[model samples]
Target: MKRIPYMLLLASLLLNIYSAAVWGFACYAHSGVAERSTYYRQFTAGSDPRTFSVGAFTVTLLSLIVFIAAVRKLRGWYIAVAIVQALFALLYVWQLS
Candidate 1:
């Protein structure tokens, strides 16, 4: 029960990393338009990059909220997590642009 928030944070981190990898591959690979499109669709499970970014943002936000609401102590740790999540969200936005 107490571990759920932490688990959510971990999940969000992994999600962002995976999305970054997918986006990077889609951008850097020297492939045909059709091939890139197909790879993007397959990597993102049929959803586009924008949609995936939004979902990742939502999960990061949810994890922060859950951590704040569930944990009574660890203020410093929470702040660190919040900072990392914020940076990730910013990176996602940058990638989309």
Candidate 2:
């Protein structure tokens, strides 16, 4: 496409990065000074912040990639994939939040 969806791409990239960060945080965040407690455990234990971030990351990456491909006129269902990916990401963020 003549115009690259920079805004969409940036948003998607940021959201994906945010999701990755949260995922990494869950794996690294400490709950106390005495133990190696992480948000990952908290999420698996009961809370669900990690899930949100993960889902967002997955959706965002997929959307951004597909969007770029579609805009660039790459063969295949790029637009559909992008739509699905973006929608999924939004839903994940919304559900978790």
Candidate 3:
């Protein structure tokens, strides 16, 4: 069977990691302290912010693992992963906007 290209796998993995990090940061910064200013509010978390971030990180990691495993057996799945990565990138941009 033809193997998937290494560069595609690498690109997907990097994009997945980047998405997870961006999502995790958003999760971590969900809540804000009352005393802190708007600019500094996101940095402070009094309540449990880990719950969301950890969940996001775990889901992203698991998806990446599943994608890697599937891509090994079935070629061309990387295209799907790349599309997903692109969507994630778009989501990141949307967040910034």
Whole-model lDDT per candidate: 0.78, 0.57, 0.49
Instruction: Output the worst ten-in-a-row residue range by lDDT, candidate 2.
Output: 33-42
Q: What ranking emerges by TM-score with the best candidate at the front?
A: 1, 2, 3
* Per-residue error (Å), model 2, residue 90: 17
Q: Rank the candidates by lDDT, best first.
A: 1, 2, 3
Error of 3 at 71 (Å): 14
Clashes of each: 0, 1, 0
Which regions of candidate 1 deviate over 4 angstroms?
Answer: 30-38, 73-79, 95-97
lDDT of 1: 0.78
**Model 3 has how many clashing residue pairs?**
0
Mind giving the per-residue lDDT tens digits that candidate 3 earns over 1-97? 2234445456555645654564456556645533223322343342233343343344444555555565645447666765665465455444444
- Across 15-57, the per-residue lDDT of candidate 2 in tens digits comes to 6555455555744666653233345444345435545457556
Candidate 1 TM-score, C-alpha based: 0.74
Q: Cα RMSDs of all predictions?
A: 2.8, 8.4, 10.2
- Of 2 and 3, the candidate ranking higher by lDDT: 2
Q: lDDT winner among the candidates?
A: 1
